[model samples]
Target chain A: MAVNDMTKLTLGPIAYHWSADTRRDFYARIADEAPVDEVYLGEVICSKRAPFHEADLPETIDRLERAGKTVILSTLAEVMLKRERKATEDLAAMETPEIEINNAAGLFARGKRPHRIGPFMNAYNEATIRWMAGQGATHICLPGELPADAIAVAAKAARELGLGVEVQVFGRASLAVSARCYHARAHDRTKDNCQFVCEADADGMPLRTTDNSPILRVNGIQTQSESYVALLPETGELIANNISHLRLMPQAVDMVAVATVFRDVLDRARAVDDADAMLRSVCRTTPFSNGFYHGKAGYRRIAMASPA
Target chain B: MSLAELICPAGTPAALRTAVDAGADAVYCGFQDATNARNFPGLNFTPDELAEAVVYAHAKDAKVLLALNTYPPAGKVDLWRQAADTGTRLGVDAFIVADMGVADYIARTHPQVRLHLSVQAAASSPEAIRYYCESFGVKRVVLPRILTIPEIRQIRREIPCEIETFIFGNHGLMVEGRCSLTNYLTGQSTNMDGICSPASEVDYARHDDGSMSSRLAGFTIDCFGADEMAGYPTICKGRYTAPHRPEAYYAFEEPVSLNLSRLLPQMIDAGIHAFKIEGRQRSKSYVRNVVSAFRAAVDDIRAGRTANIADLVALTEGQKQTQGAFETKKWR
Candidate 1:
């Protein structure tokens, strides 16, 4: 496989809760300063929060586009409500930019509209990738939990099918999404009156086992691994697999610095040493891990220190 | 209306015959590989066993549905493709598929075989189901266990396929076909490996306080008192303490079986084409008892008599039962 200088960096849509201003400012700064190739902007979490930033989406999209970034409108992770369906349909109808479908509802609504298949769509193999490409998908983000061998196979298939492949490069991996909101249920409130308590933690709350070992993170309805999925050490394998893009999900702190480190690693490959030092400087919470890429237990940490 | 079909799970060849003799209208089983969700060792049939089981079911005037539900790991599509071919060659009635690639493979190559979208696919809406039907020629869809009766009725009016629902057995409140929490904890998933808390990783220890703790991969999933029965240690059914909750509670769902015997007539009236019993990991006696009870209830409902089905509650999870996402969403 040939590595291309056009290595794309995609800013995956925020998977955690943030206040309206915080979200607005994060994207505005991403638009102006971040060295990203594409920006996926929309509410991928609870539908109740969408209305908070719904009015500002157009301005954000415009600003990101004016800053020489390709903007892809994103859809919700799960679509069960009437308003959610309408929101996905409205996003599919937007003519300004392409859409990245996170669920089957979004894929159905797009219906051959030439969209990007988000990681949540479950395209793990060559056959599924070919099917999605045949359905007019131009880019396919492989599922976050898939092993590296699978990623290589999928990247090969994507190259043959003439589509782009993107992998999560940083941030807490989204483990699962559910219809029931544990946050609201924990607070003794129904899903209807959740009081938007998930916004208190800009990132999700750390979930530890009864033994007090950090194991997971709980957002509104989505559960994520506590270990931040860092793919910086596997840059060589990713390049060998013909992966065209790497996705970085938005976190609460030092996001621009995070993007800059990835940019340095992608640009100067071998010149960028000390993966641990880079991660320690940029990460605000949780230790960095790349075990998912090595096909080991995702929670296990692989030694990335260069041969001393 | 025609005779209501009773679909039962068969983990092995002996279980398949047991379910058939118990008067199951159809028996669903999986191959001994990752292609099926019930990928337990000592359970599920080999290719030769499945061929013989299908012949046995056909002789008994019953059908066999082969579960090829797992999403094929990348570079291993050949295994799933071969499983589809083997099922079709053995004359299985339908292929219950969860992956788009598997569905497409069966739809294109073995067009003669019937395709039933497994609940794992998580196609919850009319549009999503309709897309599968229009694209892949799916004949039936195993509806997810999270819909209300009214929701199922509304969906039936929209899609062009038969609907098979879980009438009794393990009821998963979480979205089917999308959960990997089990694999996260125990390194095996029902969707990928067909085993949730595989027997190798599970252990039961009696605590000093007379409570039994069931652990999976060194993590305590649940603990039950002396009188309370210890259910299987699945991630979803495990008790945990959240931030706001003071004590340990079921953060996801309580361990409860879904007994919709009381709602059979309502489901039938709502246009359900089949009623499914969900214990592939159970004993032969359980298969015989549950199938016979449901068979009698369906016949009684057809004969216009008051159907009674309360004795089966003892077999439910936690020794209690609930209508589960059927009556209303307020149970949450």
Candidate 2:
């Protein structure tokens, strides 16, 4: 049951605007209990959420680092306002802990300094990954929409260039980001007068189709899938393709226990069926999906044949 | 201020002629493949047709900007590279590119050719625009539709390359080259496949309640009453129900087109170099009327005369239009 030694488990940035106390507690639990090797921190969806938690960043980073987990700060996925530009500049100027850039403005600000490419940045092909490597990208988390074959090709290209390749294996898939904040607009509020309404739905507001089918989630300006993307069974294929990391996006579930289950599966200590049952129990109401990896509709649940 | 060049869309060669003849300074088109953003079926140009289009456009002193804007999939860069080679050989005026790979290839292979950053690249900030201009020698950037007038003016002052903003047509507020909403439901995407809510997967069903539901791949996007006009269900403009709201709402945007007709003078004063129209899937009459109207308007503004705005609600989607975010940040 031994996996690739480089196949580390990573936690993506929190895409929601949780209260500063809640964020501190979440990071404290993750720092001490989770089996993940890396943790990404920042307010990636909205700039308005940064100020509420800025004073507590040093303690979170120190705790994660002290617990032997690598910490990476992420930039805003969309930078338009003057404050956002300044924030990207300030983060890009840092030289200590690494920065994961999600927007092109961060790329310009970093300017050949080594940084990680967040999943929000589109790295869909070998040519694009190679070009990013030329721009000093040391690691890249591929876009969530890319299919399996494309991931294999991109992973191979990245491996050949000595860059780390990571793929999201758990949690809600981020589908789209917009200039306007849908979470606010849905509540009859403009983005400017949102009043931090997104802080209500920590897991994101549920958006249902006309027939009342729960299909999508609205997280501030981002649109995400209702089902969590679980790829526990496909870890073998991902490792075979030379992927170096598996990312699990932070959600409201018991992430410490969730990370333990994934770690058990990765370590060959638990059977796939047992792990699947455990995950289902952990994520009670949400469904599991791997259709994006199977080259079908992302929300589809293509049943996989049992492994030999 | 100098009159800004009018850039128009041409899905077919006939539309190309119509645009140029209607007073478009330049016409943007794509091959009948995934290399361009508007890779719709039965639309776009073949190599032979593109050669003829270049000749016809050059004869009338109009420029032909070939759009190879979609991202090249892994292990399939040859298609985009070959398309670039074809466009270069066909004597196109410039290339509108979105992917960094395609931009790098074009910049390295054909240094003499001009490169314009497509809106699909989502280069909304001055720093992002500067990165493209410096890294790949991109000469012009079609700014995304999310910026306000003051933001555009500030960006124009900071960046070195020419600026192009959408003046009419699709008010796609989503950051281009990044949206995956359609792909989440249909397995196809605008960034990789050059289609959004593709027509092939779209269907309409009449319910027993005397209402029709517009769907993409069987997911109900919106239901229209008998008297209400049902717009095409592009994912962003679709209506959906949320938990806090009692009724379905346009979570992203309403069904309307962006018509910045009255802001021509202010746009010119903001140092915009080109004004772009965003409908490659539109008809020949649409091309003619919109192009001629904007042509006369640009002329009137440059000549210090008040431009007469025309009523173009019929040509817009849902028979309605708005000035969108360009007028104010409050539209969000």
Best by DockQ: 2
List clashing residue pairs in candidate 1.
Answer: B37-B194, B39-B194, B120-B177
Which regions of candidate 1 are displaced past 4 Å? Answer: A1-4, A269-273, A304-308, B1-3, B205-212, B223-230
TM of each candidate vs. truth: 0.95, 0.98
Off by over 4 Å in 2: A1-4, A306-308, B311-318
lDDT of 1 by residue, A225-263 (tens): 777888887776687788999999888767888887787
Global Cα lDDT for candidate 1: 0.81
Model 1 residue B269 CA deviation (Å) reads 1.1
> Which of the CAPRI classes, incorrect, acceptable, medium or high, describes model 1?
medium
Q: Choose the strongest candidate by TM-score.
A: 2
